[model samples]
Target chain A: SQTIHQWPATLVQPVGSPLSLECTVEGTSNPNLYWYRQAAGRGLQLLFYSVGIGQISSEVPQNLSASRPQDRQFILSSKKLLLSDSGFYLCAWSVWEHFGDTEAFFGQGTRLTVV
Target chain B: SQQGEEDPQALSIQEGENATMNCSYKTSINNLQWYRQNSGRGLVHLILIRSNEREKHSGRLRVTLDTSKKSSSLLITASRAADTASYFCATEGNAGGTSYGKLTFGQGTILTVHP
Candidate 1:
């Protein structure tokens, strides 16, 4: 069975502080990884996605960035966090085939609160 | 920009009643998927329907996709309180850009099933 792990279930950070959120998947390789943010009572926003190692595609211009250092490891980083960056961060992975894409599996998510 | 938009930003229902959520997308797609998210939790993929397929059923859930209309709908029969959560629609576009296998999500519909 495949599973995803995300850390620091809840985080409280000050404005201008650095942030790093990690996500790792077990039991899969070469899976497409994605990072999403959700505001309270709102829909999700796609932030970043990776199809392979060291290859990442960003969906929007934002205060955050993401990297895929390994096949199953994805990291979301912000050199200096802003108050607007506080939200629920989610990590997800999907299998891509020549035919198309499959359903995505998601991690538990990280709740970041910047004051 | 987000590719899919779910309708009826929110819904309220009772157990034993049915709940339906609709979504509309902007571009060509290989497939469309629906997901469920509990409060402050990661999303769980509910179902997927290919562009060529009009309707699909998984247990008590029924999904319909209309490529011509660029829209889809999810129906939950005999709803339960446990089904209370936010539902989102996502589209996997056929477009080839720097971002491959991207699942763009909509604003989501909040479903509240009162016991």
Candidate 2:
């Protein structure tokens, strides 16, 4: 069984402050990792994804960045936070397989508020 | 982008009643997946239906996919108050060649099952 964990369940940061959110998955190796943000009353917007260590792909360019330093550890960071950066951030992962559907599982998520 | 759109953006139903939500996407897909998210939390995968399959069931969830119509529906039988959450449909992209884990999700349907 694989479980995803995220830290700082709720955060309140001042504008222009730095931000760092961590995510890690246990019981899975080299699983695909993803970062998503959900705006109020909107859909989940993909920000970044990683296939393996040192491999990160950005889906949308914004005030956020993601890094995978280890196979099971992923981090989302920003040098300075913006007001628009406030949202529910989620980390997810799925097994790497070809052809057919591999479902992605999500973590508990972190809610960030920028003032 | 290549996202799906969920119909009946919001649904309210009483407990013990059935709730159905529909999602329509553009282009072809390898599979369609449904997920549920409680307020300010990560999404929980409910079910996945492959393109070749027309239906799937898990617990009280029933999912149906129609390739010709490029749409799918999720039915929750005997809904409970705990089932109140936002439901989203995600589709695996139809890019040629190898398939990456690029999932475009719908705006989502908010379901409120009152007791």
Name the lDDT value of residue B80 in candidate 1: 98
Fraction of native Cα contacts kept in each candidate? 0.66, 0.58
lDDT string for model 1 (B1-114, tens) is: 777788889999999999999999999888899999999899999998887899999999999999989999999999999999999999888776533657888889999999
Cα lDDT for residue A41, candidate 1:
79
Query: Which residue pairs collide in model 1, if any?
Result: none
Candidate 1, B102: how far from true, in Å? 0.9
Worst 10 residues of 1 chain B by lDDT: B94-103
Kindly list the per-residue Cα lDDT of model 2 for residues B1-115, writing each as its tens digit.
5378998999999999999999999988888999999888889988988889999999999999999999999999999999999999999876776455667889999999999
**DockQ score of candidate 1?**
0.71
- Taking the candidates in order, what DockQ does each have? 0.71, 0.68
